[model samples]
Target: MNVMAKAEKKISSAFIYFFGSFGGILFGYDIGVMTGALPFLQADWHLENAASLVGWITSAVMFGAIFGGALAGQLSDKFGRRKMILMSAIVFMVFSVLSGVSPDMGEASAYYLIIVRMLLGLAVGAASALVPAYMSEMAPAKARGRLSGLNQTMIVSGMLLSYVVDFLLKDLPGEWAWRLMLGLAAVPALILFLGVLRLPESPRFLLRKGDEAQARKVLSYIRKNPAEIDQELASIKETAKEERQANQKTSWSTLFSGKYRYLVIAGVGVAAFQQFQGANAIFYYIPLIVQKATGQAASSNLMWPIVQGVILVVGSLVYMWIADKFNRRTLLMVGGAVMGLSFILPVVINWMMPNMNPMTIVVFLCIYVAFYSFTWAPLTWVLVGEIFPLAIRGRASGLASSFNWIGSWLVGLIFPIMTASMPQEAVFAIFGIICILGVIFVKTCVPETRGHTLEEIEEQGTNHGRVKANNPEN
Candidate 1:
């Protein structure tokens, strides 16, 4: 190839990596945006209906995501990944403005805000499912873990962005501060919409549709070495042929077949348990937790989340470096054990010394953040995105993502009530126990996905046994 051609291809490859992963920024931004905005929202609305509004506003997006994820999964399979991602970008931009422009606090206004936020939820829900799948399909085999793990980096980075934005605008008069935080998300959404315009559809998706020529064209830009490109293309073609031969239909019941049952179980278990382990409780209500523990006013506690966000972002960076180097199952076990201990120690300390320093709780939370950032946060997406066969990757990922959002919805909804009605130690202890169970689940059920192509992993089923991909005939 000519030097000019090589340069052009290099630029194109870089764009694919950068813009392809860009959807994750929007996903993370939306998730973390509300964390910082919630405090100002409560103050503006004055919580006369605080209890109900807090739960509804925080959980409304998650509720929308449940349906959005399931729908996107099915639709992406039928239509295409690029189109779904582009569509999600539009959804994100439109509803972010709507959410920001919601009317002043009132009975009708609160309901209106919840409804708009739910619409925003749809965009984020689609993003959560689609981004990882898109990246996984596009990435080279050796770097799939790090590339797929970029989604989590973007998520925590978005959280940190929101926290910083909230802190900068905290002193702004009236509700405008919160409005700006929520609405500014549209900037990234608009960028994503434009960025995805030039992106190629996933080669796997194209091969599945029998458009091998176009798939090869797309693969050439991303994979520079001719031999490597041919190897990947052949793998995808064979997998597509196998899928066609198997005559798989995108049905929910297919998940229960003997071969897929274990994959689905492990995928869904990790996805749900990732949320139930309660790291989001830290993200969603860190200010409230700090306020409760430190005896500070809720409105004045915006700076603390920066601490959590930093720990999270740093941990994700660490994961990016070591992601493909270690066994996925081993990292999961270690992370879960440390995370569980972080929660357990705080509860025991608080119980033993009723007047323990508030910093003690903060220290434990940081440790939890450190471990969770590397493990559950990124690995859940990695495992779910790559575990299923090409025939059911979209649908299975959607189902797992829906379970994830459902768990998120439950945590966002019940956490406040749990805190109000019970001791924080008891609440954290409950999560601690869940994390310990998560360790066992990883050891027993979850398979090792690193260092293998998605097709290869699906064929092998698990590290413990050779349970092949599902056969529709059986």
Candidate 2:
């Protein structure tokens, strides 16, 4: 690898990272945008909605996401990555505009809002399932974890952008600001649509489609040398060959056939548990929880959510820079610890905040957000991509991702209910317990994916060998 060629490959990887993560940006944006937008919407619509209803409004996207994820595996295989994302961009662009512009729940039904959100979730669902797959496929093998981490970066970037937009609109009167914030999402959707237009299809997908020449073209662009291209493709081919032998009937039952159950189990279990870890309870309900903690109303407490967003950005940047250096499993366990501990941070401060200065409460919240971002925020996406086989990668990922969204739905739905039923202290403690258990799961089940190529990831599924975090790649 000459310096010039290496430089060109780096440039190519950058483009792949850029375009691939753009979907994640939308993922992050939609996830956070609604949390900030909802407080005003309930008031503007003149509805006497409770916190539970608001939670439903926020989670509607996640609910629809379940189907979106279930279908993406087939869609990505049948239609390819570029088309799936383009279609998703179209869905969110139209749905977001309409969600903001809805007239009346009675005439349109509050169900209209739910329908629109589900549509938005569908787009995000597609993005969530396919973006990581596309990013993983396009990345250089040596840089896979960092490259895949781009999706998580986008997720945090979205979470942060939502808060930033919310803060800017804090002074705006009525729900118009929230409407504008929701509408603003179309910007990234449009960018993703156009940017992906210029982007090529994944070489791995192309190879699956039997376009060897086109696959080689994409492979050459992503890899440094002609030989590296061959090596990359060789691994992909080897994995695909092994997957085909595992069986091709395309049933979940087929996943149980041969050794594929390992993949199906690993992918789906991690995806579901990733969400079940209770990280999203904070992501979706941060604003509500913030208000409860201080006994403040939504307008006054806007800063509470903004602080959370900024911390997530800081955490992701730090994690992205260091992802390759540590074991992926250790990072997961560590992130769970950060999250589990942070859940207790507010309990320590809620008592002191009335007598203490506003700055004191802010500091505590910042620490919580920092720990969440650095640990659980990005690693969820990291493991999701690594835990499947080539054959079931699509189906299994779709199932896992749907399960992830379902777990998200559970958090989004139940957080409000739990908050209603339990003391804020109890809710926080429950999340801490979830993370503590997640730590045990990481130690017992999750495999390390750092420093391995996609080919190497594929080999694990077929060979029945699990890579431990501390073990060196042989």
Candidate 3:
């Protein structure tokens, strides 16, 4: 009976973590399924020449994400992370079906899909912000990086699943193919909703709510040792008390004030740069890009996303291995340098050869995805989850997530327009420059949080503020 009880506890803990991070699947599926669905959508809606409409349809989720992230952040703080995730799951299920059944009314059909998808974006944005914070809170500092990275693993896995689904269903007659692709997201949303029903609230949130007995109960399941649970709860309680006394009230402006300002800059900057570096431009439209460069049929181009998806999944697996071992700054800097070169090399090769093989572009993009999957893609959320103080963590994380979506929205919205007007090499070259700047930002602004407890990280931020205050010249 004792052995059986231990096994059951382990199983329950694993399920909690799995469902806690499962929101990433919903987020990743919506972003990726569109890649396969867009071509069919264009044909079904007669939008072949309407580049701007395509951009809006592609970017609409991101636009909605901006508001959703911000709103969820505030609400999660007040209501708790578990509740917000459940709410997000419900939003995802409803809007996903609505998106699939959208009536064809010419241009209005496209507009209708955009509106439904934008509503779906609410859930996507919430998941993006909630998963990291929840995962970070549940995990021990030693394992936090690897555990939190599970969110990214789930995200890329969802993308891979979407790509595979797109390939399998690409042959379905007419609009039904894309419609089913959009509606299928509801399945995962339903799974997340049901699974989250059993998840415990964050122990830290429970402590903040002045529910010590419940917080202790929640921590017992996550932390194996009773002594460690007591220590962690005490540390969290002390931090919460100090934060409450110092700030007295939390607001959006709190993220930009005092010691938090520096932390916010680092966290939000990392989040924005992750998207601004143009990974999504490839993820969202690789099929279209391959068609334009190689003069291949769009239908044939669907295979390329599966190739990218495989690379991403493999890279994410590799990241889970190295996540705790390496310094966050080291990974970000190295990945940024390589990713930037991947983009620039194609432009340089084309200049030297005058007619570079289009397949070379595909090879270089795969390299970019490989590096991004392991680094900025997962580390951004890891850092965002670690760097903020407990009092404002929810709101600050939301601010960071909103900025992430803003960058994604811009990339998705403008990539087609920019490609329409300029050389593809030139467009990618711009992204390469942004990558270099990102490396600089990480080196100077971001601190090393590897193996540090959340309390210790917050203390480091506080100490750094003191150092800066004492020596203004530094």
Candidate 4:
């Protein structure tokens, strides 16, 4: 290729990775937007019976996401991955603006906000499932972990953007503050939609649909050498053929049957545990938690989230650099141990002192954020993207994503009520216990997936009679 052509190819590859993973920004934005908005919404709406309302508003998007993820799995399998992502981008922009402009219908305003948030959840959930799958398929095997890890990086970046926006608008009087925070999500959504128009569909999906010519054409955009193109195409084709010939009756239940059951357990377990470990309590309600802990007003608590958000972004960058180099299970366990300690130490210090510095708890929370950002935040998505066979990849990933949202919903709903009744230290102690359990689960159940191509992972599936095997070096 000429110099100009090479530069153009490099730019194209950059955008493909950026725009392909851009949905994660939307996912993280909607999540972080509410963290800043909830306190303002409560004040303006004069919310009575506030805890339940808070739970409903916070958890509503997660409820919608469960269905959206399942539906996207089926749809993306039939229609191309590209189209489903485009659909998600449209949903994200529209509902986000509507959420910001929610009407005040007396007591019904809460219901309206919840409804709009639910719609936003649908888009977020779809993007969560589709982005990882699409990126994993398009990227080369050697670079797949880092490319897929970029989704989590974008997710943290989105959260950081929301935090910055929230801090900027926190002083605005009445409802405009939260409105801008929620509505501004549309800007990123628009960017994702327009940029994706220039991108090609996933080559694996195209090849699976029997369009080898188009698949090769798309692959050529990223793969320079003809030999490289032929080798990857052959691998993808071989995996597709084996999946088709081996399992004519691949149902969702196959995930739970003898051979694939363990894979489902590992994939779905980590995804669910990521949420159950209670990170969202910090991501979604840090201001509220700080307000209660320090007896300070919610609006004044904005800077703490920005601090946490920075830690989160920094940690994800660390993961992006090292993800391809380590065993997936090793990182999960080490991070989990640190995360568990971060949670447990705060509770212990608070109990021993009884009047300890709230900033100390915040420091541990930052530590927890740093560890979770690199480990569970990224690797859970990475494992789900690579572990399942192509035949079952879409649905299984959707199932795992749905389970993830379900855990988020439970934590979002219960955290407020639990905090209202119990002390902050005790509440986090519960999460600390859950975090330790997560570490145990990772050590016992999860498999290592380093240095394996998607095709090699699939071959191991064929040999082991399931999509993922526990031996870790197959």
Provide backbone clash counts, one per model: 1, 1, 0, 0
**Ordering by lDDT:** 3, 4, 1, 2
The candidate that achieves the highest TM-score relative to the unseen native structure: 3
lDDT of 1 by residue, 269-388 (tens): 899999999988888888888888888876698888888889889999999999988877878899999999998998888778988887787789889999999988999998888887
What tens digits encode model 3's per-residue C-alpha lDDT throughout 33-150? 9999999988888787888889999999999999888889889999999999999999999999999899978777888888998989989999999999999999999999999999
Q: Which stretches of candidate 3 lie over 4 Å from their true place?
A: 1-11, 466-474
Q: Name the top lDDT candidate.
A: 3
Over 4 Å off, model 2: 1-11, 47-49, 105-109, 244-247, 344-365
Which lDDT values do the candidates have, in the order given? 0.85, 0.75, 0.90, 0.86
Off by over 4 Å in 1: 1-11, 462-474
User: Candidate 4 overall Cα lDDT vs. reference?
Assistant: 0.86
Candidate achieving higher TM-score, 1 or 3: 3
- Per-model TM-score versus the true fold: 0.94, 0.91, 0.96, 0.95
Best of the two (3, 4) by lDDT: 3
- Per-residue lDDT over 1-474 for candidate 4, one digit per residue giving the tens place of the 0 to 100 score: 577545544547778899999999999998898888888888889863589889999999998998788779778988988999999999999999898889988779989988888888899999989988998888887788899999999999999999999999999985899888889999999999998877788999999899998798788887778998999999889878876886656668877776566677888899999999999999998998888878898888999889888998998999999988787888899888898888889888877897898778777888899999999999999988887777777888889999999999999999999988998778888888899999999887776677788877766554564433334455
Candidate with more favorable, higher lDDT: 1 or 2? 1
- Measured with C-alpha atoms, the lDDT of residue 237 in candidate 4 is 92
Clashing pairs in 4: none
In angstroms, give how far residue 441 of model 4 lies from its true place.
1.4
